[model samples]
Target: RHYGIVYDNLVAAMRAELPKTVRFVAGRVSAVEAGPERQRVSIIGQPDVTARLLVLATGMGDILRRDVGIERRFVHQRQSLTFGFNVRPAGASAFKHPALTYYGERVSDGIDYLNFFPAGGVTRANLFVFREHTDPWVKALRDRPRETLIETLPGLLKTFGDFEVIDRVSSWLTDITVAENCKRDGVVLIGDAYQTSCPAAGTGVSRLLTDVERLCMVHVPQWMASPGMAAAKIAAFYDDPMKQAMDERGLELANFRRSLTIDTDLRWRARRQVHFSRRRILHEIDKFSPSFAARLRGLKRPQVEAVT
Candidate 1:
């Protein structure tokens, strides 16, 4: 929840609007049991709660999926690793811009990209690596984050300028996955509880949001009007065209980002060269004439900078 997302604040603000009938029981869920008539949820150190329908919005690591006959099949294990830290301009050098992005130079380097931006009163750096967690590089990062990163990415310091990692380097290893055998009675899994997204693809939140909108807004209301909480009704949500498309798109984008990052095929190699070359050209043009750069952007040619 503390992954620099605004969800905590949003929920905190919504606390005041909670109706008297809606009692918020805050505790960890230990077990879940679901049936056609009623669903029972067991919380640690608390009495069980029964509901007509059970919604599992827990992200990524919920064990309740198995209880509802949902399966998580990993499409790719150890897909990517991400590092989050704060950076500031070294000494009095002073950053000229509020944000900047630096792309990885080599596939062998195992670096995907690095994003440096201002958030929560600090310049936050999100770095994506396409290497195994057990790799020596990963170990080096854990032990000496700044030096290891600079070593792996030679041009990083020169491009982003010498900056210190002013906080603990938070890291995450992601597994690309999708839930199977999930269409069940009375229980529905949403967000990362249903499908896992590659952080490097930046589609995790998008997929989760699509899940929320479809399950909550589109399907649930219609189901409530009907008779039984059968698997058939639950399957309709998964069969929804929009939800299917978004899930497919998330998988597609995940593959695209991975290929773009480390695929050394001739075609991809050329595209990568052209991709950065075009940005360099535009950057030079921007330096020469800000107005001209803004005007040129009206052409709608995409200027993509990987934000990790």
Candidate 2:
């Protein structure tokens, strides 16, 4: 079963594990000046500081990246909409399942999927849809979330039990983008600052963490062992095989999710039917011939070449 945790709580726990030597200066960054040997940061109301290398994990906001002449190329515009809200069992003590994923039954609904999971000591509902912001359903959903959800997803109540939404609804519109012209001196972009992922694909954090691992654990020490921090040094992290694969896979999965949810073409329709059927078949097979089912699954899995 899937589980969830509050983001702030997770961050706090991570912060507690940090070394005391690490100091955090809280200030708005006004500008950045990057060079081969040093990187200068200008804070709105604080003294300027310089570092050997600059790493940006600031997310999709691109003002800082733009300051360094880095531009983001849109892979998909307004790729998907994600809605978040808290829910509680209407008349009961608890829900039927602690975690559940409900897929869209009809293609016309433009709904991808809805996830109900435990988070922040409450049942959290996250709905992903592929539709325009101007769509009437978007407004109706914001205005009357519980009723609209039940109406849009008829099987929701029967499957997950009755629920009532609490607190305000939060929504995010994602645009798939990748940073371009990022091979610069003394600076590197990570996470959403480098590329934005579709929430539906569930690869955003995977790619972000991969960026951190490859840069810090692998490349940073190698770069620091030398003298100058040139564009060539920064390019090594970008050119890392693991980072490239994760970034490329994120985009591929994003496209796959969109096409799977909305495409009405014969190929996709057939694929979708086969997709569901294959899962059911594998489940039944696993119950009987477990070893055979495992072998079948192994055969269907994609092969990857070693990145050494």
Candidate 3:
């Protein structure tokens, strides 16, 4: 199945299977008023509810975190537009065989990465184009999404040839950071609300799921056992397990970002040489043993994989 389809289906399934015992209140959580025995949660919708413990499931709301004195590191940039295309039979032939093709320097500023994956025993293919995060030219045309996409299409066509436009999507602005810690007393943040990393490293989604699973399965259960035990357990969970995961993933993302940036002429030459060297090695490896790459990736898997 396509990754996008799989992701959508998984989300839909989760939303469909609501617990009968657990009442889900859909609204914005404005405030959390703590009391002696329970906590009062202020909801923007009609009536509010009170609970023994409150779980703030807000995702990536930096404004609220800042109001509570939690300092974030990443900067939120403007949103970007994504364009997709259907591969024409003739155009698909160019990418029938597995190959890496460089689209060109992005109209935004830096170079954009384009990749094509062929469908097995078919004339259909999938193409992905990574745009620059913050490009001056792209930002200038942000208000005109269609014009922005039209302007960008030429750069893609110049490298990949003819194809039919399938769908155009727009993503919200997000922040990226390397800081690991995202927890505090009486309140915990999950998903983008806490910390964020570069998407290129593929850590954001996995890390967010890890946070949710860990909180719900381990920390929440212990907290529910007794109010006296809640504080210590929360502290331990955030300090040990959560902190370690974030630290490791954050370091990996930081290293990757550092490797991509060029400060000097010598550094630029070194980066280009390294990039070519890695490409050549990968090409040779794929030619000899196709499954070796998969095995290498599997070796890096965590001991426990969390369910999202």
Between candidates 1 and 2, the lDDT winner: 2
Candidate number that wins on TM-score, 1 or 3: 1
Task: List TM-scores for all candidates, in order.
Answer: 0.87, 0.91, 0.65
On residues 1-308, what C-alpha lDDT tens digit does candidate 2 reach at each position? Answer: 45477878877888888889987777889889888999999999899989999998889887989898999999999999999999999988999988988888889888889999998789988899999988999999999999999999999899999999998889999999999999999999998899998998888888999999998799999999999999999999999999999999888888877887899999989977976687679879999999998788777343221110
Please give the lDDT score for candidate 2: 0.88
Best by TM-score: 2
Q: Write the per-residue lDDT of candidate 1 for residues 172-275, one digit (tens) a residue.
A: 98898889988888988877788888888887777777887887788989988977788888889889899888788777777777877889999988877887
Model 1 steric clash pairs: none
Candidate 3 clashing pairs, residues 3+ apart or interchain: 60-193
Better of 2 and 3 by lDDT: 2
**Cα-based lDDT at residue 240, candidate 1:** 87
Off by over 4 Å in 3: 6-9, 34-37, 66-69, 73-109, 112-135, 140-161, 164-173, 177-184, 228-233, 261-272, 292-308
Q: In candidate 1, where is summed lDDT lowest over 10 consecutive residues?
A: 299-308
Q: TM-score of the candidate numbered 2?
A: 0.91
Residues 77-178 of candidate 3: C-alpha lDDT, one tens digit per residue: 321223323344334556333333443243233323333443333223222223454656545444553344346555655445544433333343334542
